[model samples]
Target: MAMLPVYILAGICLSYIILLLSLLYGWRNLKNNPRFVSPFETGFSIIIPFRNEQLHLPGLFDSLKNLKYPKNKFEILLINDSSEDDSEKLVQEFRKMHADLSIELLQNQRESISAKKDAIKVGIDKSRFEYIVTTDADCKVPENWLQGFDNYIESQDSDLIAAPVIFVEVHPEDPLFRKFDLIDFMSLQATTIGSFGLRKPFICNAANLCFKKKAFQVVGGYKQSGNYAGGDDVFLLQKFKEHKRKIDFVRSNNMIVTTSAQKDLRSFIQQRLRWAAKSAGYDDSFARFAALTVFLMNAALIIGLVLCLFDASYLQWLMIAFLIKFNLDFMLIYKAAVFFDRKASMRSYALSSIAYPLFSSGISLTSLFVGFKWKGRGYRK
Candidate 1:
């Protein structure tokens, strides 16, 4: 019976190792092979929802101006979710400057807990095109963003397409915590792609998502999980899966969207808590299983380290166990880093790995018992 703790630790680590292996296999299976380019035939209604995002609005507007897609094929709908700052003024100025482009600014009518969802619903209602593409106000789209979606739509019969999102590049002289944030986010992007490759796509980001307006209406337009403020992308993805609508992930790097990371630890924690709080609304069993397994593995590692301090005998075994998980994590994240062309960020991976168990466990626990703040508002699961 004295060996029971070791057995339990092995079980937890083994389960996680298997999960990682499957994700690695899935990642390998999902490839972006260069192919003959298709004509940009699908028209897109670009929907952007914002609160107080005056600082990031200019970057988005600049990116929009640089898009290579035909101006007549896409329209921009900027939904203002009660911004108190000069965000509205920025959008108005952009509209006046680019009167040749189809752009409209609309106010968000809050009918649900998720203000972003309400804003998106309003945009979809006003959209003129058949395809609804969404990105956050803080994100900068690539020049081929719409063209990439059009190519994918013309080739695939998918109803929803999820593309990648990455953080702005981190310089070597930047703070170590910033690299940590980039790696953490890249892991999420990797998992997203891997899950799609495995044909169990569970999570997606609103920051780079495209779907049919008919699919949105068919799924009842977030009415199923409208109570949650944070899962505007994930819950909608779950709904698509339930209704058997075809979903695919765009594998091209040119399709990526760039966004900023939280600057400080306090804001980072709050952001993660807000994300964790939305897990309660996830009906996808694979998503829940993946979440629980990751949490348990991290929590187990923390407990094992604590036990090592009390008993020296646990040190060697714990180190071996830690190395096993560490190598697996490195493989997954390193692949993602290469895909995003941010392998330089991997220099901080060792330090970040040592800190992650504690950080993840704390966030998971805090999210369950405590509320988190987003966009100047507080939320609970």
Candidate 2:
């Protein structure tokens, strides 16, 4: 029993030290914030794929109205993924309401298990510009989002770019969840951006990611891994990383996309499980290593907790383990929060920290089952 706790303790310690070192390495690569979210004179076709987005359209339209870019320079093409709801009608409503901007509704032609990827592919095929940016239909985008992408593209000689996604809700409304969970998420976001700064990044969200049309085609356009119900972002990112280390992490708050929070715990778990399931098939070595380290750290912590229930000696070591985890996580998240301009909701972070490890550990195990329900559809890996 004692040996078990010691083993787990060592794993957490080692992982924390590595994360600390990586965070420092990332801090040095800071550059001027590229304003891709703004309305530059350059033309762009923003691709937003949707199945049922009726509930989110109000917020979406509100954000669309606030975009700082010129209406003539960029257009919106919303892909309707056979939504049973009135998503197409909603788009029509928007078009009628705002006649100044180009807004077109494209029906997604179904081809594979990855419906979202197919929608994006269809959008890519229809885009008019060399720069293709993808965001979710349910997100609230920053006004200057396009300007950041444009500036970054002009400044950097890169093809693939990863942008940050922030949570829009101030409070999750959940009962007594620590702010640490939110903090941890921000830290992970920072680490992702930081890794790009260090020129070894492997994390990105499709909620605000952009790519050059040429590089996306050069990598064969997700055909290699389109079967995955998830990973439209990560698999494509691996291709970018492999082809060139020129992958950039977009850090400007203007380039960020703010997404709504999950409605409840069940939704949160399923969402996280979907993310964890993709870890098994990642192509990037650095990504795999990072995932493995996080897994080991969390898994070990859970094991140590079980051991502590029987062996009293592990109690002190537990405190040390938590302190290391908290301090390191806090440092990374603090930097990221500063960049995102989001103050940490520490109440959620502290409780979320305790729940996050167990939550991640459980989802990692559940992903081995290979099939899950998403949006009332069955997805199999």
Q: Per-residue lDDT for 1-381 in model 2, tens only?
A: 447657757776886688667866786575647334432645678999998889997788889878887777788889988899987788899999999988888989878788899999999898888888888878998888777777777777568778888775355554443243356567668777777777777777998888888788987888888678888998898887777646777666667788866666566666777887777878777777777777777887787788788887887787788778777776777677677766646545666677777877887888988667676687775
Error of 1 at 283 (Å): 1.9
Model 1, 249-313: lDDT tens per residue? 99888988999888687787888898888887777878888898899888988888988888878
CA lDDT, every model vs. true structure? 0.90, 0.77
- Model 2 collision count: 28
Show the colliding residue pairs in model 1: none
Instruction: Give, for candidate 1, the lowest lDDT window spanning 10 residues.
Output: 31-40
TM-score of 2: 0.92
